[model samples]
Target: MTPSLTEAVAQAWPPAEWRDVHLLAAVSGGADSVALLRALHKLKREAGGRGRLLVAHFDHGIRGVASADDARWVAELAEGLGLECRLGVAAGPPPASEQHARDARYRWLAETAGEVGARHIATGHTADDQTETILYRLLRGSGLAGLAGVPPHRPLTAACDVVRPLLEVTRAEVEQHLRALDQPYRTDATNAEPTYARNRMRNELLPALRLEFGEGVDAAIRRAGQQAGEAQQVVGELAARLAGEARIDGSPDEVRLSPALLAAAPPLVAREACKLAWRSAGWPEQSMGAEQWQRLYTLLCDAGTAGLQLPGGVDARWVDSIVVLRRTSAD
Candidate 1:
């Protein structure tokens, strides 16, 4: 028998000790999500008043009728289970980029959670996704923060926290569970296409890796992610402290960093502190890249660089020992 997702979630969640907790299960009509919804339904049935279980789905408008079909299938599933279902459809042509689609999906999920007064949004991110994510981040030359693959839970919006109960469960296990239950799920044809990096990784790279490295790759990577999270905690604490120390009097749109303070911190600390300052100044987290980090780091370490240009039309320059970050004129 497959271990229960509800059991796993019961152990890690109820983010607060509220008696009645509302959860919005994000379903995409895929095997993993179908299994998750079933498991949540089981949990909800076993323990009444553990709050309500709701379903949310978003159509990216990319796969045309198929995407709409997924939304309908999810709605039917929710109806069959007697749960409220919320649907969000992208109005315009869907963005071609995966990240854009993901962003829109998450925003919709968060927004739906808020509307339903749910405190948490649950997703079907399994260990296979975790392995793929860490490998992808590794291939992308991501630092520890990015390498901290698929967090088990994190705040999505002010009102909702996204929880991944299946982070330790494999996709194979999810498929197996669905099969055992005689569950039907929609398959996205794009998943098998080689055009997408994740598809290539899942279809080709992972199998090749398994052949070379053996079946323990998933376990090893899971351990690595856990260790990375522990490590990130320390780094995050340091970054927070450094961000406080580096902050100087400035307008909300501007963040002034003490160059000497930043330079004195460890290299990683300095980099994260710069990111902290950048975020404090109301810039998006993804706005910074390697070049942006290097530019900011150089500005801190060198102290003589004329100015640093960042993504999102942001700029940074030094006034003696103080580093100032401000929105670009165009912004």
Candidate 2:
């Protein structure tokens, strides 16, 4: 049997576990978020709250009046529930792209949460979102880690985490809960726009696939994502250990590794370790693709004579059986 919205939320994050933490819910006046906020409020009431509930909304102004309306609706909704609301409006015109808008929203959420002393930020990402994310990453040739889709929780800062209480709940369930409560929500027309690939996928591709293969397609994909997540956890732990063990010498701008130690590990492990190294040095990885990582892995394993330059002004070369990755002046 499909779980009710409240049951789903409780299953994902029990009141007993989080009733004492200051949580900021990221609500965009959509059905999923509205349901999430309402369900959490109900749980808190039942748990006899020891903590505070905060609502946060970021208006990107992409739709001008509609965008502002969303922020207003979220604030009003929070106010009705007697919860504090934090509203952030983009300083300039709306962001140029969807990615930029998402980035801005998150940055604002983090900042707002810090100001309000929230230890966690909860979002309304549902199971359908997870399936869409997994399919999108698959289409882009993402690796296993990418195929794992959206995580249930992740650290946004040292003291704060972003949690998705509806990760296992379906959008249909959210709408059902909202309908039961006679709650209203804002619908973003941009979600139906054809210009966005995700919109196209959600409207056309997934629906068409479901028609051909039945509803089980979504379940199968979600299962694959769950399996991928489990596998990635194991791989991540090994990579972290390998990265730690192989590091022999390092400075502020450079990291040195034992080529023999790296070569001893599996290719995938070594490659992931290299990624960890890049992150530790604060090097930009926006342009590093599968091919670039593979090249670095090969160089590390083979001790190639030719030195190669990487993105973010990093250079990789083999020196006396040691792999030295240094930040150069040139990109």
Candidate 3:
């Protein structure tokens, strides 16, 4: 039997975390997001109603006028729920990359949240998304951190938190809840197109996996990601503590690490220490992937290797008992 709306909302843990927090729901008019909006709206009417729920939509400008229509649809959906709706649109056509589009969407959401006094920006990222992300990262040879998949909550900006309330709920449960409500949701035509890798995975591989591994495959994958996420949290804490042990030797623009301490450190600790120095030297964190980090760490450990050039114009070199890093003239 399909789960009820109450059952679906029960998995959303935000209300327990903060009282009187304003939430801005990101609705794309899809079933997942629609269910999120409706559930939150219902919860808003209950006793000790944790906070007010508002709606926000972003038009990527890649889908021609259909994207704009989507914004209108979400606004109307909010109206139906007796909530306020806010819309943001990209200035130009969305960049060719999915990452660019995602970045644009969140950047706008963060900015909107700042303007509207919302404490949390909520999206409809479900357990299925966590599964897909873990699988995708595994295919591309990601490390433990990457395998952790989508986090339930993260800092979107200094003032706002990006939260995924449905991470414990499956896509099947979301559709089932919507069915129980007899609600209407619009489908994005682009989801069927296989140009994107994620679309291909969803359209092709996931079904094959289900067939071969049985229906529990999705749940299993999500569990694996959750375990990885938990393990990564421990690693992050260790990394932070290791970063503290590193000897800071220069200004923020040019950071130097103590070679003697790094060489004496364990491999993992040393890598994290180099990462700390790299950040201190003004390197973009996202630009350093797992392999890139491993390579830099290997270089830091080997006396034979002298220097390394990383993305974002950052350069690192060994100088006797210290390693120095500086940003160069490169984009």
Q: Which candidate achieves the best TM-score against the true structure? A: 2
Model 3: weakest 10-residue lDDT segment is: 187-196
| lDDT of candidate model 2 versus the reference | 0.85
The TM-score-based order of candidates, best leading, equals 2, 3, 1
* Candidate 3 off by > 4 Å: 1-5, 14-19, 48-50, 189-195, 251-253, 284-292, 302-317, 326-331
Instruction: Order the candidates by lDDT, highest first.
Output: 2, 1, 3
Error of 3 at 253 (Å): 4.3
Q: Model 2, stretches more than 4 Å misplaced?
A: 1-3, 189-195, 250-252
lDDT string for model 2 (1-331, tens) is: 2238888899899888888878899988888888899988888888866778899988877788888878888899999999999999888875777777788888898999899888889999888888899999898788898899989989998878899999888888888878888889987723211237887888899999999999999989999999999988898899999999998777888889887888889888888899998898888888888899998888887865589888778889988979899999646
Q: What RMSD does each model have against the real structure?
A: 3.2, 2.4, 2.9
Residue lDDT tens for model 3, 1-331: 4346555565566456644878899888898888887877766666345567789988887888887788788888899888999998888765667777778888899999988889998888888878888899888777776789988889988899988888887888888888888888887723221237887798799999999999999989888888988977776677677677665757767777666666777777677777776776556888887677787777667767868888878887887766677787557
Error of 3 at 44 (Å): 1.1
Model 1 agreement with the true structure over 144-171: per-residue lDDT tens digits: 8777887887998877898887887788
Better of 1 and 2 by TM-score: 2
